[model samples]
Target chain A: MSDSPIDDLIQTMGLMWSADGGPRIAGQILGYLLIEGEPRTLAQMCEALQISKGSASTNARLLEAKGVVRRVHPVGSRQDGFLAVPNPSHSLLKSVAKRLRVQADEISDISARFPDERADAQRRIADFAEFYRQSADFMDEWTARIGPARGETAQES
Target chain B: MSDSPIDDLIQTMGLMWSADGGPRIAGQILGYLLIEGEPRTLAQMCEALQISKGSASTNARLLEAKGVVRRVHPVGSRQDGFLAVPNPSHSLLKSVAKRLRVQADEISDISARFPDERADAQRRIADFAEFYRQSADFMDEWTARIGPARGETAQES
Candidate 1:
């Protein structure tokens, strides 16, 4: 109902990230930092987003851990600030690929324990494992290709 | 810990699917059906898995919707039996790719609404959109390559 474009965009990203298994608040925090394009203290984030200080802090830490956000400390200042990591697309893909690799390894190990009579089931599981492994490899290649752009952004910062 | 290998495998699959955003019970059901390699009635699944009838039914329906399970009716029987679909790896990958495509489209649309002054944010969003779009295309190509094997499995059934 609110006709604010920025607010709508933030809410949309929040929903998307929530669907991706992260907290909606973390997505909102990332959205805010991306659009604001500046380091913001926890207090400023809470004030601007009309969220509780605890919520802001918790989500900020979560996003930071996920490599989508980073902590910043201004010179001569005791308070910490947060900023969205530039070009987080590669990190996000890598995280997903890492999880898929874990799944693949787990399934492969499980299939190895199957009895000879269950060879069919074992083969099926192996196929699934192979699919995940290949997918992870593809993602790794993509991450490498994007590495240069990410490095350039880091240098600019 | 139970020394039952099959139980351990199903539990592991449940954990993986839970992480992938599906219900754990659905993953367990898929695991069970994959190993069992035969059509099973809802009652049989409930009794074998020691799960309640409600849980079995709900999870079975969920798996079926995800293309991981299929319901078959035995000739002259009123009850429906479920079997793990052949080559679910392709379906699973396709499902993930479809979801990513949807996310890419959503983010692309959001980026289009950004004001001209927010070009930096717009460009970042565009890059994220492209990454997801490309990932989806890669998955699509993989799925197509596996189509023949999937068809052979279907013919065997």
Candidate 2:
């Protein structure tokens, strides 16, 4: 166990993200970027986090795709760098809300195929679908109040 | 792929929950209980889900611990059974909210230890902590409006 506070934060994030089925290294990179508050080269990340170059590069791209981080061209550096986006938790929450909506759709689709005799199952399925749908809506409202996600315009279409 | 609707639902839940770092079998069992709408013996679960008795027993216990299901004594049956609680998704959401709160706490604790030289990191850490805290609060309010979780009283102290 490291006595460093930054290490503790990195490990906390790594564990949390891994628990959500995300790569632990991605969370660690996010943590590193969060505290460093600057764009970091892939090599710098590998050196600081003690991770392989390939792992750092892959997870950095993953985080970029998730909108939790953005790629940057660091001055006087050959390699591109990654920086944590402002309010990254919102981006992560937005992805979760999207999944909840998908789950709702899947339940609704399956529920439509039930036989007439399976009334109980139909009712239960409807309830489950509604819960997920409403949860997604709630999340949308919450994230909206927090402001637009990275690269998103505040103006409603 | 199976053309059965329940099978589709089960697979969907299995994938979703497993993606959230839960046991796939547990999600399958939850889906089974959701559509079945009744208590199921471990033997019946093993037979219908085609899972090993050990897997059925373990996952059932895990679900019960998560408050998504409850153990019950089946009439005229020596073996105990498990039943899905009403609105099990609420329980799952509640658990997620609790985790968000924990993350907020961890971030806050680490932020307090930052030195005067780390003003930028402190500001960013504060934003991250606030997002998690508010998100958790939003989830709690939403779940409360939806009604009490299984075994929870509606009355607030």
Candidate 3:
């Protein structure tokens, strides 16, 4: 294990997110920001992680676009700083539900294109679509049950 | 769109599953088998998908291992046949819950390594772990609610 707890956490998160198809460095940056609990300039992050300024900048932008990270500006500092966004879990779940809905819609459209004679095949496709649609609906309900304010309160306790 | 509805469905499923980090060919095979609703020999799958026998066999084994597809043997048939496994959505949700549990465990272990002075970081890590843990629990409850028999009955209507 690394001497620094933060370093270990960053590496672990990087691997975890990479398993879910995200960029490793972006995950690390998010991990670092979450642990720091304060905005960090691109230069500072690059130095801390020993990565190039270009890589750090690129990933910071990507993470921001994903709604898990945000850019902040200090009162007098010219350089922009980045921090992990609050309520990331909610954002992630919402995006996942959105994607699943798109997939379900596509499956439904494809099923409709089939002839009535292909009932079995059509039924299978419809089932697949329903599965995704239901899963998305479940996410919506779950999110409402665990709304951001309540989630934060739960975490504080 | 292709003249064959099967082809269009397979392509759409291929894209959807590939986005979730699964092999595109494996998704296509799963889609094809689900629609075919009958055991298909490896050669037939390859011919229909215009893929090599090697690729078809490899993806079929992969899907089978994932529990989304099953191998079937007909009486006195020399060649092995494959079909989509029943209750695949249940299996998939269960597997996802399992993976989330593993992630939560990892996060917990990492949190234990943090020093007392790193309280903020430790809290954030613990919160992250909790999110995954709760999500896994949700999946468990969801899976039980949609058990195989119930799921099939619902689909029939």
Candidate 4:
């Protein structure tokens, strides 16, 4: 309930996370975990984000499955808590790259159904997808070079 | 049509064009116009961009309306054709900024309806939208400084 910049930051992130890229809801949970700063209980997330508890739980679990955020139980609490890995910008980039790859693949498959008529379009799709793949790889390298924020220290993979 | 790299380039371009950060058929038309090296007839675009004649006509008009692309008649022919300006990367930055602006305005209007309890969440949305305005401006400046592609010159507005 405190006025924190992180609250704004969280919502901004949710806009991106909730971005369907076509039509999607994944963005909300990513945004919440992103600014929570530490692992938080489901109740905290639902209250803070003003989303239904079921929605919070579902999206939180989705983030964990994608390896963008993780589930970590606090020492004395029975309730499950979650934390996003430090340097989530890298996570964000990788997620985008992976999804783009899927899109590229789907486009390619669609092109395939059209026979030789689509050969050219198929090639273009594959080539551009390759561009995105390289772009994503380049981002991974670039972010790693920039390293973590001062004092936080980078966590080794 | 011949196997012009430009055609593959256009096909790839079409595939790569995004509206609001997601791909749109309008983008491909813009890409084709950007690189086809000359204004293309409605016939040429329909063939190259792989859209219907009506779709090409409709989208090209929309692009013209947006000031991103233009309609032109060939030197002496009666054919209707179009040309795309070589915009800088910052053009994308600016367009994205514009979309964020619209979202921000929507937040302001939407907040007026929330009586009390939901006021904070609406405020969060309004703040979130404001942040993108600053971000979009920053991106536009940064992109302008970066300049255009190596060999391709961009005409500054």
Candidate 5:
């Protein structure tokens, strides 16, 4: 805690990047947005993180693309507020669904490609992917029952 | 989904890389080891993965370091038994503990570094890390009660 908001933000970013999701600058941005529970302007974000204007732009855009964060526009104002998805757990549910669908497709393609040659291995892979979908669904239901991770403020959770 | 054992191994590696644990190459190795079930020689692993001999050695060493895979010596043989740890869910308990310990210490340092000036930001960062530890503890306990994942024979469901 360097007694500055900027230092704290940087520290949070470092911690998030060190986690499982990703070890990248964009991850840092998402972590900050997700945990802060506040909407911040682009300039404010850049200033707090002591990053260049261009770098902030790129990182913010990346976060938005991930669907974990979004750009919000205030009433009658040009300044954009970059806010994290209001419901972190629910968003994760959606992500799980999308990722599982894609993986299932991949597994299907793999099974088709190999035919009978590596049949056992291919079957196992597809089965595992299906299991993954089950696991994700399990998490979604669990979260819905428990709560939307601490800061999400989601109603259902 | 290719029936090719080799392709499955590669795809398995990619899946582990994207899983709940950090993106670990050692985990990739572990997945392949699990699929083979029977222990493999280091030479076989190197050939299948298409990596250099040195890469296989180093990566195997890394997997061994993580406690997710083991190097066992078969009876009456000098060569080691390259096998996965068998039950990964319990292993996750230990890994989560280690990761959370590091996170706790890092967040403590951040708290110390921050003065009273940026109290809100400092609080946000601290809580974010605190929640991660709480989540880890919860998941670990749940998994322990639920038994193992990744094809382990469940002791109890």
Candidate 6:
């Protein structure tokens, strides 16, 4: 643990993401941005998170593509800034639901190729496909109920 | 892709799993069992899946631990068999919900250590914690609504 609680928390985020099979430095950059609640340049992120400039830039862009971070141009600022998006989990959930739909489609495609002798197997595959498809729909509904996404005004439920 | 559609499907499964950062052999074993919908010995799995005994055994055990496959013993049979669990996605979803709960706890713990000057950061952390906690509960409810697990009789909805 570091002397600063903030650093300790950032390390925890890094470790947690690594445990989930993600890059540790990406999680660290996310943690730093989330806690700062402000736009930071690539150099600033590299300095504060103690990560290499290349690592910071790469991960920040990755996070931006994933919808958890944004690239911003502050007034009169020469360098671009990175800021953590509000409700980052929503985007992650969206990707997961998309994956489930893909799995469902793949399962259905495979099920169509099953031999006549494996009728039971086809039935089982059908059930699995249905489960994944339904799960994707459920996830989409759940995320919708979570309210607005980043930079959007809240709407009436 | 292989000439046999079944083999092609299994290869697809392996590729998908590897893409997701999981063991490819495990996904192949799962695809084999899932298509057969019957228990087979490790030796049989190795021979049929064209995998080594070590890879087949280890990946089968790994799939078993993940609740996607189970070890079974046919009556009067000396050797054990591994069968794909019905509705395996339910267990995977359960594990995901459990992980969300862990994340919520970690975020809450870290939020407590933030200094007074970072009240806005604390609020954002609280929002994230709330999101994770609610998501865990939502996943649990959804999975519970998915009907029976492995070997259980279907109940009237």
Instruction: Specify the highest-DockQ model's number.
Output: 2
Q: Which segments of candidate 2 are over 4 A away from where they belong?
A: A149-157, B149-157
Model 1 chain B — which ten-residue stretch has the worst lDDT? Answer: B148-157
Off by over 4 Å in 1: A148-157, B116-119, B148-157
TM-score of each model, in listed order: 0.86, 0.91, 0.89, 0.53, 0.71, 0.89
Q: Candidate 6: global Cα-lDDT?
A: 0.81
Task: Supply candidate 1's per-residue lDDT for B77.
Answer: 81
The CAPRI classification for model 3 reads as medium
Q: Point out where model 3 deviates above 4 Å.
A: A1-3, A149-157, B1-3, B149-157
Give the distance in Å from residue A49's predicted Cα in candidate 3 to where it truly belongs: 2.3
Expressed as tens digits, the lDDT of each residue in B34-121 for candidate 6 is: 8888898999988888789999889987777767777888999998898888877677777778888999899888888899998898
**lDDT per residue as tens, model 3, A1-157:** 4566678888988898888877899989988998888999999999988899999999998887666787888999999989787567776777788889999999999898898899878988898789899999988888787875322212210
Q: Which stretches of candidate 5 lie over 4 Å from their true place?
A: A1-9, A18-23, A27-38, A65-70, A84-134, A148-157, B1-9, B15-28, B93-101, B148-157
Clashes per candidate, residues 3 or more apart or on different chains? 0, 0, 0, 4, 11, 0
DockQ of each: 0.49, 0.71, 0.64, 0.11, 0.26, 0.55
For residues B1-157, could you state the per-residue lDDT of candidate 3 as single tens digits?
A: 4667778889988888888887899999999898888999999998988999999999998887666787878999999989887557777787788899999998778888888998877888788788899999998888888875322212210
Clashing pairs in 4: A17-A27, A18-A27, A20-A24, B14-B28
How do the residues B1-157 of candidate 5 rate in per-residue lDDT, one tens digit apiece? 3446456655655674656544455546665775665778788877766667776678777666655666777999877768766555455455656676567567656665666775765666565566556546655665566566554422221
lDDT of 6 by residue, A31-97 (tens): 8888889998999988888889899888888777777787889989899988888887678778778
Global lDDT for candidate 1? 0.79
lDDT of 3: 0.82
Interface root mean square deviation for model 3, in Å? 1.4
lDDT for each residue of candidate 1 in A39-120, tens digit (9 for 90 to 100): 8899988887889999999999887766778788899988898988776766677777888898999989988998898898
What is the RMSD, in Å, between candidate 4 and the native fold over all Cα?
A: 8.2
For candidate 2, list the clashing residue pairs, or say none. Answer: none
- After superposing candidate 6, which stretches have Cα over 4 Å from the reference? A1-3, A152-157, B152-157
